[model samples]
Target chain A: MKLLTLNFLTCAIKTCKTNPASFPLHPRDAELEIQEADLNLTFLKNILPRLMWEELRVISSELGLPELPATPPAPADLVEPSNTPLDTAEVTLAEGGAEAQEVEETPSQTAKDLHRILLETCIQEGKLVCGSCGHEYAVKEGVANFLLPGHLV
Target chain B: MLPTPSTSHVCFDRVYEPAEDSYLLLDTLSSPSETSFLQDRFKHANSSPPLVLEVGVGSGVVLAFVAANTQSIFGRQDTLTLGTDINSFACRAASQTVRDAIKERENGRSVFLDVVNGDLGSAIRPHSIDVFIFNPPYVPAELPDLSRHEYYNTIAEGKKATSFQQDSYLLQLSYAGGEDGMVVTNRMLEQVPEILSDERGVAYVLLCAQNKPEVVKARIRDWGSGWNAETVGSSGNKAGWEKLVIVRIWKSAD
Candidate 1:
């Protein structure tokens, strides 16, 4: 399962719903894999507001991945400065910033790094243990199992 | 018309094959009226990308369709899609179905999170989902006995394949809703209010004639003031047992 998915999941047990610690399920004995794909800057920028930076940092730490920035990246932070190497609009009318031309901003390393951490990194096998009740959810072959025992349910 | 996501690679013995109910969801979600509603609801570009969650994503036809065509359906390319199924086999098959669908679209593709194995929306965080979809087990049959779920959910230790009985049990989890078919849907409906995003959340649920569509909608309306439920799309085929309709549920300012 992608670390991005952990943002929206919680302990499956009924009582844990109200517990503050039920969220950000901690990863244990995780096996990580990187599957690269084309990164879209717009998506990374737009998804920033929804992410919980502290929790994600905690997860990143638990998975033994590189540390994430303490604060989420701003939309502008994902883009390179004005002198973009891969500018789609190369032939810009640069008449001393006549009307301040709108060129598509190139994605920066920050965007690539965020994409790598959230989308590309996957847990091939692991266990997600809830903080509140200490319930463990198993992850196998990249799919996590949140199904609880009948008694627990 | 949007092309239905292919589930040809899924093993029908263990996963529910896309059927009329699934097609109805496709038709409704892509229809002009529904698309406009979704697009308008999620038009704000700076707002965090809308999260789409689908419970019981058997074969993942509906979730894949939404993920592949998020530009047309939600009017945004950054929509996030997730899925969950009670049966583990369906969960794995659905993850691939959605991934392949997203990969097929060169542009305007949405992100797909993993499809986990869980009951309804039990594993979802509170107030997280922006768009919810469910092609529930609306068949009016005795619900499958889940006593063997643990044993049937996985292949035997050191064995490469699951037994035939396990496959049958897994398939039964896809359908066979008990007692007027509301047994499962009711459980899911109870979680809708708690799981949906406060301001922009919406849900599209498929129900058959036996499920008493009117009563279900009425109950949803009674969720509170401003809580609304309406049939946005219907097959209009009353003769068959699978006469289906898609109910769009949401809340609006008075």
Candidate 2:
């Protein structure tokens, strides 16, 4: 699962739904896989406002990745026209141009870091422990199993 | 705001690619009537964005289409899209599909897409979902065909299996509804009230003739006094035409 997905997930145990700690299920022994995807600035900027920034900061720290800013960057700053050219090499490469030189121009640091956490990082194996119930949901082959036992369901 | 038809190429063989039933559900969601109904609700809703979820999001095409249309067509931004699928490959494919769908939108709306690998909607917080969509495995099949071992074995052997054999494996998980094609859908229906937002929760479910849409609607209405069910859209011929219908359910104010 992508790290972005963990933001919305909470413990499924019926009794745990209302508990404050059920949310942002803590990842434990996570095995990370980084698969590079073409960064879509529009998507990154669009999704930033919806993210729980503080929750993500805590999770990112737990995963031992570079820390995200305590607060999300202003949406306008992340999507400024200047950042658009950072992906020119990708656009040209997609057009089948062999001479396209990789542009060293950097995107906003916030965009780069958010891209890494949201799109590139995949959790291949681990367990998501409920902060309240202490239930460990297994992650196998990048899929987090969220099914509860019949009684729990 | 229609979903790009290229999703089939992005979906892996094991992933449940968009099919006729999926399109029918999309049609129901994007139709002018449904869009207006949702828009009216958005206008009056409180500060929080409505949480929209799709259970069993195979290729994630349905949720992607809704997210894009909810903004581009309806001019509404207060909606967050979430999806879940039992297939691990599906979760990945869904995430990719959602990303591609909204990549070009210039709207400053906060469009959030998150996918989970879960059974039904098990990972979702109860009473948090404002709109729920489920297109379950709705084809009747023997119990053994639904086994996880059988599903993996079929995928391991590749896609060269005969049509009948293919139907018994991972593909079976997509279509094998079991016991009148309502087994999985029924399990989901039971959890609806618990998972749905108490104020104005709405659900769109896909059903075909064999599954008996009328029976399902009756069951949903019976779930509680406030629940109501109605057919929002239907496609194909009445006789043996694989007729699919989208059923909308919601709780009426007391």
Top of the candidates by lDDT? 1
What would the per-residue lDDT of candidate 2 be over residues A1-153, giving only the tens digit for each residue?
Answer: 778778767887768877889888999999999976556555565566557788888889999998776678875665445646646856777867776665434457667778889767988899999999999998877768786654565
- Every candidate's lDDT: 0.90, 0.75
How would you encode candidate 2's per-residue C-alpha lDDT over B1-254 as one tens digit per residue? Answer: 46553485453456777888888888888888887877766544333566788998888888888776666434455466788876656777787777667665555343544577677877776677889999989887754432353244324446553344443355667778889988999989988898898987899999888899998899889987989999998886677647889999999888
Estimate, for each residue in B1-254, the C-alpha lDDT of model 1 and write its tens digit. 78889999999988999988899999999999998998788978877899999999999999999999999888889889999998888888998999899999978878888899888999999999999999988888888876557888989999988889898888777888899988989999999999999999999999999999999999999989999999999999978877899999999967
What does candidate 1 score on TM? 0.95
Candidate 2 has an lDDT of 0.75
How high is the DockQ of candidate 2? 0.23
Candidate 1: docking tier: medium
Say what the interface RMSD of candidate 1 is.
Answer: 1.0
